[model samples]
Structures are given as C-alpha cells and as structure tokens.
Target: MACPLKNPLFFLLFMFLPFPTTAQTYRNISLGSSFNALQDNNSSLLSPSGEFAFGFREIAKDGFLLAIWFDKIPNQTIVWSANGDNLVPKGSKVELTIDGEFMLNGKRIRNTEFVGIGVAYASMLDTGNFVLANRNSSIVWESFSYPTDTILPSQTLNQNGILYARYTATNYSTGRFLLSLQPDGNLVLATTRFPQITPNYVYWSVKNPNIGFRFIFNESGFMYVTSKNESLLSTISSNTVSMQDFYQRATLEYDGVFRHYVYPKSTSSSAQRWPKDWSTSSSPFVPPNICTSFMESTGGGACGLNSFCTIEDQGPTCQCPNGYSFIDPEDERRGCKQNFAPQSCGETSKEETDVFQFQELNNANCWGGDYALFEGVPED
Candidate 1:
C-alpha cells in the first residue's frame, strides 16, 4: 500500500537531479577543436582520408603496424610502416601509451612517449602528406620523407650513395648481389663482393618524369611502375604512355632486379597500358630475374634449391661447347666442363691429334670453336 500525494516532491527531486555525462570519443580527421582534442589524447593516428580512421585494428591473424592508406579504398595500400615485419599479433594486450610509446603486456616503450599507451593517430592533409605529429603539432614523422618502393611526382630519388643487396635466391637476406645507381647515372647489378659495371655500361638513367609518377613493391618484392596525371585525380596513365614525353623512371626490385620502365605523356588521354611498347624477352635476357636464375642453375632446366629456374638464349649457360663434354651432365649445379685431355709431352701419336673447324652461332648454348677461313669469300 503506497501513500499518494497531489504535489509529488519525489518527482520534482528526480527531475532536478544531474545526469552523468559520458566522455566523447573522436575518430574522424577533422581540422577543428575536436581534431585538436583527439590528438591531445596521444593515442590515435589518422588515415590519409578524413573519412577513414586508423590506430589499432585486429585484422585476421596479422599483427599491428603503423599503417596509413585508404580505409575504404578496396585494397589497403599500406604506404608506410612503423613496424613492417615486426608485428605484434592480435589478442595481445597492446596499446599506444600517452607518452608517445607503444606498450604491450604492461612492458613500457618510453621512446614512443608522445602517444599514450595504445594511442597513436594519423591525419590526412590536402597536400597528400600523412603526418604523425604530437599535441604541439610538431611532426615526429611523415610518409612523404621515407618512400618504400614508389616515388611520387614531387618526390626525388635522392642523389644518394650505393644501394645493393644479396642474391640469396628466395631469401631476403643480402647475398652476393648488388643493384646500385652511380653518380654518372649508370645503374648496374652484379654478383660480386661489390657492385661494379664495366665499359659496356649500356644501362644508365636520369630522374626526368614529365608528369606524375607512382611506384609500388609487390608482395614478392617485385617493383612495378604506375602513373597518375599531375592535374587530374584518380587518372592513372600507362607506364608506356608516359615515356613518350621523354620521361624515364627506373625501379630496382628487392632482388636487385633492374627494369627500365618508360611512359609517354601524349597517351595520357586514353586508357594506359603497362610497359607500353616495352616488353620482356629472353633472347638477350635483359631481365635479371630470368638471367640470374639460369646462371645459378648453371643451365639446368629444373629449379635449384631456394632458387628459381629459367631458360635464356644468351648470357650464362650450363651446356658445354662442341669441343667440350660435360663432366657430369646429370648435375646441373656443377655446370659445364671442357673435354680437352692434357697429355704428357710427346705422349700422343701425331695421328691421335685432330682438329675440327667451328662455326659461330649467335644464340649458341655451347661453345664449339672458331672457323679458320671462309671457303670462297675474299680476305678483308
């Protein structure tokens, strides 16, 4: 049984009581006070687009890395990495701390002290530069400075020193390989202690892209070329079309593979095709990936341990010359061996000595010998 009153004091008190206010959580890339306060938290990073947010995301089985690209751009083109290979997997208690450090399992990383535990943010600017800045607006790092594989229009491949890596077939570990661009504009790759090019320096390049440019490193570390219009957004031109305007860009793959990609500016109005008029052939076997594999296998048609196999019309070969026979034809890794037997002085009879004339073959797999003289042609 409850007592009822016409003027209810309980109702009045309830109405006047203050309600609890929940804290605001911001994730968009806006340029107002909301953006300022968000950075003040020291735990969020912005994506290149204001529409998409970036910080920490648990994707399938992969770990977390400082990634910035298009959140809604179908494919996540991770342009930069704070930690590319060093990924801490999901389900692990990890957070960007307020002191600009990343913390995992209570282990503090004070070096990243600006951002609080589990906190780091990125923002997109009109200039296309995604920057990692602090609350004071001081930039800690930016995507424009460090390039992974692509070189945008405004970016320059710095006039830096030697850049080379190993040739350990499948492994990324530096092997006996080198791909370096010399100050004289020559780009050469060789299998030696250091990168060295000879007098036949047929390969060299300059930085002269007439318009816009984009480069990428595939999952396999194969570098590719892509083009965009300087004035137009989302207009990707063909690698071949851009070369017509006397513009050239060279990319070296992680495997020390060199590719001369050309683009012509006049063909920008139409749909662009990759490599344009340029194509890859095995004849001269300019493709390092193809030639290198052949050389490694010593001409064996089959692939070798931790190595890719290929066939080529020129360059190194496993087959022996006509006058030579293989020491072990079954062993492709052993390469070829000459058949000439060294005899003791005056040990062989004069009749045992025989010489067969040889003819030169342009794409000959094995060396036979050189012809002495022409039958009917006059001497030079």
Candidate 2:
C-alpha cells in the first residue's frame, strides 16, 4: 500500500541518477598521476609492442638498478641504467609524481623538471626510450639522452658523453674503462687505476680531427660522427645494412674494449642466437694488442700488481712471479704476494750466510716500477 507518487515519477528519477565509478587500474604500466611501486610484481612498464620493459633490475641479492632492456631476451639485455654506480635496495621504486617530478627510491632525480607544464605520463617506447612526457605528448626527459654503458641505434651521444664500464660481468659498480667523446672531436677509450694518482692512458682513439660534435648509431648498425648541420663526418663501423632487422648495441666492455653486438629478432634452436658480436675495434688500430698495450702503473701488465701478463692463444693470461703466490687463487686480477721472507730480520750471521740465489722471471713487473737496481754493495 505504497503511495503512487513514490512508486511512479520518483522511482523513475532515482533510477536515472548517476552512480560513482572507480578509476581503471593498470598492470605493468603507470599513468601520469600514479606511481609504480617495486614491491608490486607487475611494477615494470612494458613498451606498446611488448619488446622492451623499464623497471628495477636486480644486479645482486639485494642490489637493484633501474634499467631499460629488451623484454623478450632470455637474460634481459640491459641497454640503459639510471643509477649504475649507486644501486638501490630491492624494494625501491621509481615514480613520476603528479607535479612532474621523477623520483627514484624516494629521491627526486635532478634536471627532470618539465618546463611550463607538468608530466602527463612516463612511457616505455618500443624503441627502448623511456620518456617523461606532457599531456600534449611533448617529451620532457628520456633515457636516450643520458646513456650509461651502452648506446642503442638512433641515439645521439654528444661530445661530452661518457660510457663507463661495469666492475665485472656480475658487478654493476663503475669500472676502470671509459669510452668518452672528447671536446676535441676525438672518440677515445681510456683506463685508470686511481684517478688522483694515475693518469688516464688512451687505449684507442679515432684520429679524425674534423669529426662532428655528436656520434650517432644508426639502425643499420653503422656508427657515424655527425657535423652540427647533421652532415656525416666519419664512419666508426664498417657494418653495412645487413643488420637492419636486428637490434644492435655498442658497449664499452669492462675489459677495456669497444665492441658492437647484435641481437636477432627471432630465436630458434637452429638460429645463431641473440647477442652475437657484430664487430670489434681490433688491435693495431686500437690497442695494438690487449695484453701489452695496457701497462699497469703498479704492475707489469694489464693483470694487476705483482703479476706477470702473457699472451696466449685464447687471450691474455696472468701468473705469479717467482717466490710469490696469488693473493686470491680464484681471481688472478687480485695479483700476487710473497710466499716466503728472504731472511729473518734479526738472525745470526750464520743464518744470514745461508745461500739465497736469485730466481729470475721473464716479463716480471712490480708496483712503483721494476725492482730497484743497485750499483754499490750494501752499507751496514
């Protein structure tokens, strides 16, 4: 026995009233107004084509580097990293704040402020460029402009650009090798042990004096220096357009080598596989030879202090000098130490008279220079 007015017109009006709606959520991607937390399993941003992804990549048990890499690759070929030298903890996150600030692990990354308006979204492009953009689609920041150790195709590296090598294959800490495009228009590969004490020794260089202000790695795997007007100045690679269909990267290797590697688009049991070396800057033009070119300031060769460096069919090899043994038997790079003392500090003349013969080692070098030569007898 309800009223007719409540059942008729009133009920019709209530049915037409708008209802509250929830905003759609995204997985493996974040909108401009949102954040991507690393604790979430799907925090990574995938490219539109799903070929690449941008996220915190694990370098060690608890160490993580915010990096961009090919998503389809088995081991994930990392191309660019945001914080290579200072890796964040595993649970750190990367977020593009609503006000347009890009924050990594709660710290705002400098120089990412967009002029005029704030960021509309941060996207991972299919070309492997991680970009911060405005609502109008204008780019505010991108990974291509700030490369770490590897440069992808179509990316331009300015004269001031530097590519630093990793400490080791498994360690993401900055290493001793550097590939820099100098202001003088020369691209050089150099190494240093201690920046304050040791001078940077040039291992390789492009001798062209008239080269341009920037270097460009084209999609076809050819790298060329370009003039200010975008004219070609010099070609760094001899590779043709044969690799147009493949993904290519030029890296400054940890062992102080500049090499070009190609990743095939497809993988098969019969296919050669991805990450095959396409070209390398060889000796005579580069180091002359990897083993002898690098003279360790403290040691004889490239190995380390108190180690003998020799060339083998495989590559350079290191060994302990006479009367010495490896500090770390598993790692030759740690160098060597004396296995026995020549004689006790305070011993009888008879004990001192115990004969000690010289054990000569070929190509032996030590830190601070070879053993000092004595022209006169000892004074006691």
Q: 1-380, model 2: which lDDT tens digit per residue?
A: 00001111111000011111221222222343333334332446567777777776767666777888877767778888878778777557666655667778667664564442566666678778887777778887888887777888778789878888776666666776777778888877876543221226676777557555888887776788777788877778757533435666787766565667665664443234334433232211234345555543333345555666555433356677668887877556556778886675364656665566667544433334542222233353
User: Model 1: per-residue lDDT, tens digit, 1-380?
Assistant: 00111221111000011111222223323211111112122222443333233333333244454433333333433333333335445433433334444444455432344434222343454233555465566666555555433233333333232333322222222333344333443333443321231221122333324322433322221243333332321211223222224223333334334443333233454424433442232111124333322222122221222122233322223344455554544433233444567543355665554543455634323211221111333333
TM-score of each: 0.37, 0.73
Model 1 lDDT on a 0 to 1 scale: 0.33
Off by over 4 Å in 2: 1-42, 110-117, 193-199, 241-245, 267-288, 295-301, 310-319, 322-334, 342-380
Per TM-score, the best of the predicted structures is 2
RMSD of 2: 19.0
